[model samples]
Target: MPATLPRLSVGETVRVAVGVLAPMLAQGVIIRRPGVVSLADSLDTNRHACRILGDLRERYGAGPVLLRLPVRELAVVLDPDDVATLLDGSPRPFTPANREKVTALRHFEPMGVLISGEERRALRRPWNEDVLDHRESLHRLHDHIVAVVAEELEGLLPSDAPVLTWDRFTPVFWRIVRRVVLGDAARDDEAITDLMVALRAQANWAFLRPRSTRRLRELGRRLRTYVADADPQSIAGVVARTPGVPGTAELGQIPQWLFAFDAAGIATYRALALLTGHPAAMAEVRQEDLPTHRGLRPLARATVLESLRLWPTTLTILRDGVEETHWSGGTAAPGTGFAIISTFFHRDRSRLPWADEFEPAIWDDGRAEISRALVPFSAGPAQCPGRTLVLDVTSELLAGIVSQFDVAAAPPVRIRSERAMPRTLAHNRLRFHLARRAAG
Candidate 1:
């Protein structure tokens, strides 16, 4: 018979709650809270959480440690193999639609693939994959996206301004988002994004807060308008053109794309910080004949991946067991929620040799692929469908920025290569000083 799953002591449970769970919630599970981000960065919350998880692992021996919270049972996965097991068994024994996730996402994307039932997921997932170009490194709309990037970026880089702050970068970033997902016509549609932001703010509260149906309806109407327009050059167009089944929730899925792109923006900004801090890596990116480089842009893509590894935007990856599943330790009953504290796996010194460093080459050398634990975009059937699109857009955006300017980290945000990378990077506080590149 299998052994019973190890249980965390009450005190240890409290430490996990405060050190691990609290920060994720405070940082905003759905939409980021800028103020909380600043605080988390100052406190180095990821570092603290990693330390706590490490201690738990050492004591419990790679536990899916059972935590008996007041409401339900949660297993904190510690081992890489178990992480693989959880992710690989997705939508069957394990489902991404955990209670907390459903509670939060329902406010904005009630019929989204992430939280959908098995029947609904079958239809929605395929539609999402096809429209997103899941198998392709460069999307079908790659040229259009590249053109959008080049056009939007031209406005971002001004001769007079030597510095770029997050505040200054955001509006331009959203314009790119609007153009890419909706259409060129939606480029100035800030009100649609505002409604999303408002709904997401409520999502962060999850079960604690009530859903705002009025605002959700408003956001839906706006998205449907863009979809109906079917610009033929945007993701909305692809969605509009694609044939859908009865329960596909086509409109519902688009919000998830918009929500996800917001995180991609954070990752992109953080990647800029990583490049500014690491001159060697930046130099490698500069070596690429970026003007003519068309395909994957491997080095630039790796930089974005490294940025994601260092500071995972998803924070906590949750899965719920739909049926009884036996593990090395014991069997988890149906409806058990499993939480993977992503930072612990991404930065654990004992397991990953370069955990604390910014090493983009790991991605190119196949090290990142070999590691089941380094899930920047997650793994298995339920992994993010937008992974490729996000990477393609971000890498292209990076190439565009570096090709035009000599980038450096502005004051208050210092990323030094000699030292270990910070456990938390506050993208909100990050700024880049860009000097115009000399004519060839």
Candidate 2:
């Protein structure tokens, strides 16, 4: 019904299929592999596709790449101008409800504020607009996490045992997440997390195993029910009191903030790894005399921002074209799904002056261009409301971790997932060798 970008080469399609799309389909949610869907695992698939797309863009002049499959169709738009059109608020009201999110998030948040269009947007705004007003509570939250990290770091390394970050920090980060999400009643949080673990295992085994969405839904239900009865002042409480939302009755909906916990954990730890890896940066962070909240000047904020750019958790966010529209030299009819890829714009030479380099100073001055380009939390009306909370928490975590341990890559360590971006660094392939820092 609309114009198409240059068709993907046969070789490139296969590469895109295998590298960028298969891994996601192989997860528990995808019962039958669709003809076309492209979500890349940074290390395994996205790297290859990024290389291919980069070449294709240079050849085709920076528009979009249409991944053609008989049963499905996905258009990967790389141009920043086009991306802005997709993400920023528009009258047409594009929807973000996609299969992948339905599979993963429905269990936790049936329709949390993450979806698109005006109704959902209105649903999300009230809470997001006010999430930051509770800064005093966030300070307490930071103190709680820092205390956890301080205590957890002690027993993790086994006296002088060498540790890879992926191995050592993963559990620690999850524990902190549990505490944050579950609050005072985190004593039995592992049993709850076990449900998520099993669900993900099924997601990865979607290809071989008979799936059970009912069970996963039940698991999420249980976790929420558990949290509902926990501390009254938790993040869930904040979600409950918010003016407009899906209502706090569904604990699953409120803890949607924790859904990004994996990404947040990896990013925060990566900040530590990055800072430790870059001595000048580490020295800059060490010199942060300002309180952690006020942007944690120079290095801390830079490391968090830079690390996110390098290995963002939100690699690609999609929107379904609700009506026929023009975008990035092409046309989209209703139901056409387009992706706003962070790496494409963040690393694009046109939008970002830094492109693929780590310069904390980009964040140091609060550059408007960088704000427009780097979309780890997304932008415009769809932009995450929890930006301040996340940044503050992440900065504090980075500041807190580095304050205690000198985190660095631990060589010769066996790890989990090897990913393109930095988010998966803690999975398996890489690790950090941390040496405790003595007090001044």
Candidate 3:
């Protein structure tokens, strides 16, 4: 057991620095354990773990309970209001430090702006300007996503089988989006895959293989080169461009920035595939009142929320405390890191109606009950800029898939890596027998 610190008085700071690690035990601080978290310990397939956490939240009263995962660890099991509290202000106020260490280790870049005070506001604006600012471009992007999905799913049809392999479906979905968004440059480019693979390997290492840190940096460079080479005029250039907003582009941190996306994007893509790849989830698409006025949008927002809730890309969003703060019985001294877990919070079945079920009807009342607890893309100044684009595009792509193909679940197969976030298939062989839907 770690040493216990007496209950912290207001104004006392939980000081943690490099080479000096102290965990905030419910009781007190302890020296962090050796092998604290290995590559294997890094999250890959989170389904069962998440369920267990949910169970614990219910037993522990459902908000802000910390866990000791074989180490004196700090984790905030959160809800929407907690999420709002943590994420609401610029440079999110309640962001945690340990998670930030992990994040910084992966990407040398200041992508921490997502949680870093001051940078949070600046970083978010450009993302909005480029991806979400213009309605037309954003909609066009969604249409492109829809078109590609239609083409791919259309080829899955006229079959008798009703099973979908998340493995296969995920790659196809990513490939289509990569092609559409990055253009034909990525079509034959093996480097994109290499970039993803290498980055995943690094993220899997976490604290276990600090040696892998250098390798990850190298991979990031290679990836940046590839992207730059792919379309000097577009994708890479835009990312390289300073967002005019101060501190938005800590470009010197390119390698880290790229890796951040690698870790976050892969998980997000996997979660999306799992939700859309399921038969029951897609059933909503057959409904009469679709978002496009022709196809179904039944669980569009619900699906996005649930998937993100179930398998949040990042375990928590970290913020550096700018000023002394008090929230829900906890005091955050200035300079402390605040970690908020939307994943744990979103799964609080007690806070949600029919929370254990997959029914979308509960949120479809138009008031969106789920929104009350939702924070998949987060909220506040650091709320994800790519969020709108992701939702719009994913929904459109899902609509196209259900509209064109008879997607269904497939038998699971063995894979080597389980620690990869977004938990991509090790074999990458998710098989699906495609059949044309009647509507098509």
lDDT: which candidate is best?
1
Candidate 2, residues 1-440, lDDT tens digits: the string is 66755677778778767755554345223121222212222354434545655666677676667777675557777666666677784425566665455445554455566643356656555555464433232433455545555565565466767564455766766676666556656644676666665555455453345556677567666666655575544555554444453442344344456655656766776676666556676766767776654433446766787777766557677776667667555665566667665655666655556655566777658763545657777776666656665666677667766677776666643221232233223233456766778989
- Which parts of model 1 are misplaced by more than 4 Å? 1-3, 290-294
Candidate 2: stretches off by over 4 Å:
1-12, 23-46, 90-92, 116-121, 128-152, 203-227, 240-250, 292-298, 349-353, 366-368, 412-427
Candidate 3: which stretches are off by over 4 Å?
A: 1-80, 95-112, 115-124, 127-129, 132-140, 152-164, 206-247, 250-284, 287-298, 361-371, 411-433, 437-440
Tell me how far the alpha carbon of residue 240 in candidate 1 is from the true structure, in angstroms, after superposition: 1.8
TM-score of each: 0.97, 0.80, 0.65
lDDT of each: 0.89, 0.58, 0.45
Across 1-440, the per-residue lDDT of candidate 1 in tens digits comes to 65668788999999999999999999998988999999999999999999999888888786599985998989999998899999999898999888889999999999999999888899999999999999777889989988999889877677788799988788988999899999999999999999999989999999888999899889889998999888999999999889788988899999999999898889999999898888877887878864476667888999999989999988989999999898877888889999998889999899889999998989988888888889999899988999988998899888788877888898986688888999988899998898878967
Of the two candidates 1 and 2, the one with more favorable TM-score, higher being better, is 1
Could you tell me the TM-score of candidate 3? 0.65
Going through the candidates in order, what is the number of backbone clashes in each? 0, 11, 26
Per-residue error at 329 for model 2, in Å? 2.0
RMSD of each predicted structure: 1.4, 5.4, 8.7
Instruction: Choose the strongest candidate by TM-score.
Output: 1
Name the weakest run of 10 consecutive residues (lDDT summed) in model 2.
30-39
